[model samples]
Target: MSVDNSKDLMMIDNGEGDEPLSQRQLNPIFASVLEARLARRQVLKGSMGAAMLGFLGVGLAGCKSDSDSDEPVTDPGTEQPPVEQPPAELLGFKAVSVSSADQIVVPEGYSHAVIIPWGTPISGALPAFSLASTGEDQADQVGNHHDGMHFYPIDGSSTDGLLVLNHEYIEPRFMHLSAAGQSLGSGGVPAFDAQVGRPVDEVLKEINAHGVSIVRIAKAQDGSWEVVQSPFNRRITGLTRMELTGPVRGSDFVKTLYSPQGTATRGTLNNCGSGPTPWGTYMAAEENWAGYFRNGATETNPAPREHARYGVPSANGRYGWELAADGSDRFVRFDASENGASAETDYRNEPNCFGWMVEIDPFDPDSTPKKRTALGRFGHEGVVFAPVTEGQPVVCYSGDDSRFEYIYKFVSAGTYNAATADGSLLDEGTLYVARFNEDGTGTWLPLVYGENGLHEDNGFYSQADVLVNTRTAADFLGATPMDRPEWGAVDPANGDVYFTLTNNSRRTEEQVNAANPRAANLHGHIIRWAEQDANHAATSFEWDIFLKGGDSGESGVATNIGYDPKGDRLDADNVLSSPDGLWIDPDSRVWIQMDSGATDPFGNCAMLVADPNTGTVKRFLVGPISNEITGITMTPDQRTLFINVQHPGSGTSGAEFAAGNYVSRWPDFDDSLPPRSSTVVIWKDDGGVVGS
Candidate 1:
């Protein structure tokens, strides 16, 4: 999700600054490991620490997903990490300079164009984007705040494909023209009493703007992309009906008034990052979904463990959807308090139905998106699948995406076969939480019901219960709490798993550990690991620091060398902060995108490419002011790259926004228009592979 410096925005930022909800202190502190290794040696020698742990963690899954057409794109069964190619052979573009300009910047030889900004019609009535677009219009147009996305080529054609993307959140101040005149509440939302409520239609529009979009895009003869209207274009909004699959299905804990049998729910909220499954399905993660619900449990009837661990509010929800003036079930469901005699008769369990990865077959428009609960419930940033064999248990990884949260690995119970692989393989699996040790090694602890003290005495009655309260179970298992683990990428060239620890301002000096070496972690870092014997399903692995994201001029600064001074890759041109979005191209070039309010040397949030073999980092692209550079993908030929610029004017103060002064009006830089999040298509003037 795109983060901002605003103090009042509760729903945005993917809960990056939410007060650390984890109170259980039994988990091992990562700082202890670093202290043991570094001890009194304060003088950092080289940029890369001398102790360089060998691993090339890719930004994306490091492999190509299947084609959206009938034929498979690439066989995951035959996938193998090719021998590392030389850095000079892949990275051919000159580094772009950082900038504070309210526009995008790329290398001298590259060109870019914007397409499908928020409110651009893709299906149905095809409403043109304007401030007057209605709640119903949003259902047919592109959603606000584009985040994680993937490009599924149509029949192997680079020019035609289904471009599926996730809308992480919305900025109400910009969404509604009425908000410009009204006095605002937190995050510039129109101030209103809870009972009197926000306008039902306004609330409806915000909800309509919060889900996934699948649009058919084709390259025109002029070498530009445009939206193609067809049955393939669909919008799965916050009100779209979906199903709950796996062990958590039909469980009493999730029995809500809407789903009496506990088999389903409505909407996927706060989608952050996304990835393609081995079976060609797209997985949209449910991140920061807890902020959408309010549990008004009193002293007698307390909130459940699932709700409490996730920090469900006792007051108004982030958007106050529950307080819609019409009092419709669609609006009232956001209030998760006990309204009836029992949990089964109320919306108390509606929050439980969320916080899981939603699987969608982009090719099948009629298919209901399934929430794969077997992967466990938490703040899932995204899911990255490891390369699968012809007959092997499929493995994948996900991070909780909150401060001090642990990383997770899910191994499927059934084996994979290219001819028969489907979503069912994800239904029965072992969910493991990571525990990074002091010796630069890590263990994957299974969250099974009977094993590892996950029994009744420990508050886990079954595998469903264990997964429902996954964070608590990891705490009991003594997993290592990381610095807001955001996204994971398995190197397509090497099996090493890479995750971006996107920062933790609360981690004190005393809490510094090996996996998270910095205290007051305002600037984030990336950590990578290779599983035991190069096996994705392996229970043990060796870990190391890939890159530390910060500036020497910033406070709480450590030596820029990261963990290995000898391998210090961070230079004046490549310094970045809060590494939020990550993707590696097929050639093993790691692409890192930023999300914080970094300035000066690191100007705006930018995307940088790194050569894993040589540790050379260079800026690729920088976004406009007050926007997050996220959701990257490329054509099968790897010539055209697509990335999204989200929440472009988010940094403006509430007073400035109320006065109709936006921080940016990007893509459409006119005085009458507000900044709209949009996708950018970039290509080299020479038509060579992007970043080459």
Candidate 2:
């Protein structure tokens, strides 16, 4: 789905005033100029190549002709080391082909089974899911639109684990219940607004569906995974009470009536991408959260500049939830209008409480979730940390997940001590925005108030203000505006960070640069960078385009020098567009998942595996039509893989639903059942390691 551009605002400094720039207007002209300078330097270096060679006492060797003889020349006194072959497991299965089937397609030797689908009951007391299930029932059952997920092994046991999932958003047609007590095709496309105006129960259900779910899943005696009832199984809905931690906890920006001290708040919305901490916790990201709030454009005192920058709308919210206030603070908080004299007396600051990285402890159901604000928030896609080492400060990287947004990193103030490390380690950190130079280098500019014009003179008063308005701070630091950056993964063996810059159609030819070279880039690309001296906490780094997403048949497909498969040719099977989900497995192979739309050249969304060293990408699996392949994880043994198929048959219309002409009926494939998002488990039929 296209992001709401108005919500993804970019305030640019153009010398006259802070002009709002659309994604297309926020070009990489600075990067282009830097690239021109680098090109000139390269020309100068080439001019002195001969002189440098002479100074090094090396002779210039000319190409030998075939007439010089094709005889083998060997040095008699020197011995050559034998070539070592990669393990068979390193080079596993062959790549699959592009598929448009209305089902999950895996490699030839692999088999898949549905582990959990939307509305599956996990709590022991919850009733089994059915068309007649109530809104309260769904609060305890599995949520809709499963996006990012992670598997945490139970006591380090590979056979059992806690599955943590993020339910991004809902399909109203599939979720709203009818007056006749039926759910499927009850209210249609307008159900989202209808639920907010009346039937407040339906709004409650959606609120419950928008957060995170933690359930215990274990391998049965037959080797299939099954949800087991345990105390660990819990649903953290939009109404759940959570504590605010770090810099912005008691700041004025987050002083809502519900949280007068700004120490706590209720719920997390739009949980998109996710990650797991080394200390066994889940980090759920809040993306596209601005649409949930109504900012009241006609209000006497408008929202502050920071609020506008984050795209809190100046009118009714996307779902109009505020209309269902009905004398309760729950629904009323969605309206960010100045209802009282001060911020603490109303819900004006409620929008500020969201758009953060919420840390949840899956092992302890009673533990309250924490919103770690020190990480700096701005539509956080996800946060992936480098491999943790004792005595070294932990470093985590995150993408802003919006058009023309910036990527950020957080280096903890304290050194990691695995025994005592927890979410508290994330509480104190220096947030920095990445500035990618066109000369194949990048810098992490500190967002500290006094360090880089992030002071009152530049409209920032405190660190909390800087952290709350991170996008504005990044703009002041002159960070490179990127394509929609979705997910980031770090190579375990080599400390290289890889990020998926999902398509940016707004970019024009004038915006293309050495890093982002595509104009009107519909097919996105992945970029990887190695920090200075392989140090995760370093401010400087070297980077290059890992691979470009496009059809192999298309001419002039852009690719970096070393990534070209065969003298600038791209392998057909490796062609994929709009890369989104990314994961670096324990074996060090990078698994890339695509989020291609219907208009994309690739037939359906797919998951591909790549040898990071070779840049050889091969398709692994494909989802049903109009579905996004997201939320990937694997067992400790690497024998079982879990993948989420979200919003199968998403564009089904009201007429189509009434006519029983569904686009996709996946997982169950039953004509009587409505399509639902699901998580599928894939493993080799021979019980070997996945991809083997």
Candidate 3:
């Protein structure tokens, strides 16, 4: 797929942390495999058995595909495993070596294929991927910078399913051919020329590129996967109509020129990590969305508390989308200044419409996505729901992906009954922010309107106001300021919750606490907790640092900071830096994806699998350069794994871009094409569970 936004990604990739890959012993299984192949070769060299054995499939393990050339993809031997599943919890594959190459690197015997890249046609008129595609065409094609994906199997068939993913943001220079290497804005964004403004169609096209894509995909008879045309293929973009649900639905905070009643809004911006609901729905988290809106209000006349708390810009917006040459209302909405006769006459309340978890029905193309405000709004990095019980309160957790931000959980007021529960359960819930105590126990500080300082005296008017100012409310309650908390996952076996604190370059030694032990957490860490008595709705819990992500010298906690062991640094087989995307499969293997700007010694961002109990982590895959490895999922049978590679070959210099070159031209190494973000389907040669 054709995608853009190199500069935007370059900005985020400018973090601190680097490391070298450690060496590991090759799997002894290879010796046995070689012997078996040799012994059989003489007996069946000319028989049908030899013809069907496909040497590539049964070849020795631990070899990476040579993606740089036109060589055929290397598959595991032709022998398929039995229908009965093998051991599902073991990390069977050997750790892959560190790589900074501009190609995907999976364990030997595991093959991966790039699927829907940005601009890949799946619905509507099925427009082909091209730099000249119109904004209208983008809405009908795959969006850019794919993130947070999941595959919903059709009738439980692992080979067929709906592949859904979120398109985070875009790079105007790379997205628009007219501005290539020209008119650069902050962080390499496409700037608005005061004399010419921005082309209305270009801005529209970018907006259309930021949202969600649901495409049906199926495995071909030859083992490769392809996009399947289905009625469910759809794109939900920034211009799509979405209803606001929960306490803030009709609240004045979201009132705008387009929706005075405040019951609905246009767009879902900055979608980063997401989760699938127990009821077969999808929830996309809005992260770093504040930069999309601007308020002209000066420092002396600052924007509203909601906007100010979330870092809404006081000047130009991120893309300056509001400066579209035609100055359309949809474009103007990006300007949230209180310039009208009142907020109702302008887009003053527009910023309030974002930063909430949006729920969409992948199977129902016509269903309007719902913004579940009861989950509380902030810089939502992603969401993870606790395993549901027949009649227990629905519980889910989310992290605000900014330095010093807090983690929060929402417990539904109404108990969950799978047969009847829906988004409404999220509409009436008690949202609680976390407070990490040095005593190894954590508290869930409730954000209910009249509780604690969250009342009129503190400027909170109602539940809606509390949620709108969730960060501020959490601050008043002395919630733990984290190291830029990102994605979270809950262990299906134990209900323990794990969160990735992806570094905080600002915290000082004076601010380091037990939960966040490092002052300048250059290489972030993961923290996990088990609810009291193993109850998801428990208000108190025990917590500890799962591990500190760093190179050899910088890895591990050296002091007994509370509950965890005081020592055990990252070894060669499992070195990592800014741990970001996280997921716990059904078998309890902890999957970690990296996202760091300065991933030197460690090469580019990579994926790893870990034993939650032993704190043992091993590299699983390494991605292309200037790319952040995020978003992951697998088929129901766990035979096929899907992960997203975003902003491949990013961080191209203006000069380099002007010269029509990029850091990488991955997925399609053609020199004429820019780097693109796309979904990758990975499978083992023997049809075994991934990671095993």
CA-RMSD of model 1: 9.2
Poorly placed runs, candidate 3 (over 4 Å): 1-89, 181-187, 557-567
- What do the candidate models score in CA lDDT, each in turn? 0.81, 0.76, 0.79
Candidate 1 regions off by >4 Å? Answer: 1-26, 30-89, 183-186, 193-195, 553-569
Score candidate 1 by TM-score against the native.
0.89
lDDT of 3 at 393: 95
lDDT by residue (123-204, candidate 1, tens digit) is: 8889888888889999999999999999999999899999999999888888887877664532456766666878888898
Work out the TM-score per prediction: 0.89, 0.88, 0.86
TM-score of 3: 0.86
C-alpha lDDT of residue 333 in model 3: 95
Worst lDDT window (10 residues) for model 1? 1-10
By lDDT, the candidates rank as: 1, 3, 2
The digit string of per-residue lDDT tens for model 2 on 14-80 reads: 1110112212224335535321112211312343333333321111111122333543577988896
lDDT of 3 by residue, 184-223 (tens): 4314655567887888888899999999999999999999
Quote the positional error of residue 300 for candidate 1 in Å.
3.1
